[model samples]
Target: MSDASINASTVTTQTRVNEASFGDYFSLLKPRVMSLVVFTALVGLLAAPVPVHPFVGFCAILFIAIGGGASGALNMWWDADIDKVMKRTKGRPIPSGKVEAGEAMALGLALSGLSVIMLGLATNWFAGAFLGFTIFFYVVVYTMWLKRSTPQNIVIGGAAGAFPPVIGWVAATGSMTLEPWLMFALTFMWTPPHFWALALFMRSDYDDAGVPMLTVTHGRRATRWHILVYTALLALLAVGTAFSGIGGPIYLTVAVVMNALFLRGAWQIARRTEDDSEADNYKVERSFFKLSLLYLFLHFGAILAEALLKPYGLGGWS
Candidate 1:
């Protein structure tokens, strides 16, 4: 190659390297997942017995969202290799070459520190400590360790996602309570089935990435059975929580209706033969996954509505 051609090629490559847009940085934060975190945290904060000042509540959520984003950045930094292999994750900032791995790591650590410190100052040390632990749990326990090592990774590692509501509760009340734990339980039990349903249809992604997802390690039949079992348990927890302090008639109605449909979906998935799945292109699995999204959001939304109705004396049963 000529010297000028080589220089131009190098310049083009360098330009590409330095051309990351705002969306690239935002993508590192995993905005979709962060939205769920923000909504659940807001529900927890609102449901707490103690009321937080509007500005303080806003600050708590902002820092919590930042902490969630930091965890995502760190996860992308570490999982860039596996991400490149997985079709669903190959478009992430690092794997797509839109952002450097080192840049992601630095952004993660910096944001982690800033979010925790600012949360402590804005709310209390208890909430700040929870946020710190949540970030550590997600980045270290789930991403670095369990995710590659075990098929049960989502089951246990789900605790990281489950912590947001508790952190929000503590931020508002400055203490722990059973209500927050109930909310935690709702998310915890829901994770395995939710992810497993995705794994059912996206089995190739996990297999390609060499992640030991239950669908990859245990076969689709076993994964389907596991989904049914967990879905039943999740239904029980969701219904039972309707009697808790956070629950009301609206929540109960949502729980009953959603769980019925969710259980039916689980049953369909559990009974599907391999031939049936292949014939339909795993449509049932895909539908179930979509329903699971609405399942959790509607449940949390009911909780938020109950909170909104509390001051008017219409939250729970009289």
Candidate 2:
């Protein structure tokens, strides 16, 4: 190639990169999602029967958050083209033209490597391996393949989110057990209802993106039914965990009431319709969405409370 042509191409690339925006970089971190990951992972570390060094726990959680962020960045990069057309994601880093896809990809890859390696050095091999799997699963499996291909994306992709607690537990114990897996199960089961609710209301956005969400492919009514079913299952699995070794009186009590209310909300969503013009059936979907957030936060909070009240034997199972 001519030197003039090569230089022109290089300059064009540099100019494009120079135009990247700060919020675009922040979007790569998936700050909204990272908050929950940090919270749940911290609770898992604290609730574990085994105790860990303070510094070690801190390091483990930090690295896990970074790994989660790395996955988010990579996901945005891979999904950017479709994101530009989706109402919900059009403002994201890549779609918004604030960050180049290649730049986000580089950042994600760097963080993925660093988070896993540092986690292994700071904590244990198990924690690092789990983190590595999470990044790969979310990036390679969910984002690259499942997301655009199936309505079951959230179901299988949910595993990536569920791993944080298990990773936290492993960081503390240097191993895994039924209790941590139960916590993992709780999050895994909760994911569908939580995400599907958003999908129901944001149906147009997904259609624009050409993403095959259940709502887009299966119809809103079917999506609503799935949401209710998953919610019920989540409630059952969550409350039932109270019977497991990880659960105590406080956790059980919280789970029962929370799950009951959650079930009621799901039922309401299932019964309502977008055709009903009175209350805007979307309101039902939105309400369920808000409650779903609380359902998870409160459940984990109960676990944290149980761990704290162990000294007085107040929160332990009777």
**What are the RMSDs of all candidates, in order?**
1.8, 3.7
Each prediction's whole-model lDDT (CA): 0.95, 0.88
lDDT of each residue in 128-155, candidate 1, tens digit only: 9999999999999999999999999999
**In candidate 2, where is summed lDDT lowest over 10 consecutive residues?**
272-281
**How far out, in Å, is residue 43 in model 1?**
0.3
Angstrom error of the Cα, residue 54, model 1: value is 0.7
Question: Against the hidden reference, what TM-scores do the models get?
Answer: 0.96, 0.92
Pairs of residues at least 3 apart in sequence or in different chains that clash in candidate 2: none
Top candidate (TM-score): 1
Give the C-alpha miss distance for residue 81 in model 1, angstroms. Answer: 0.4
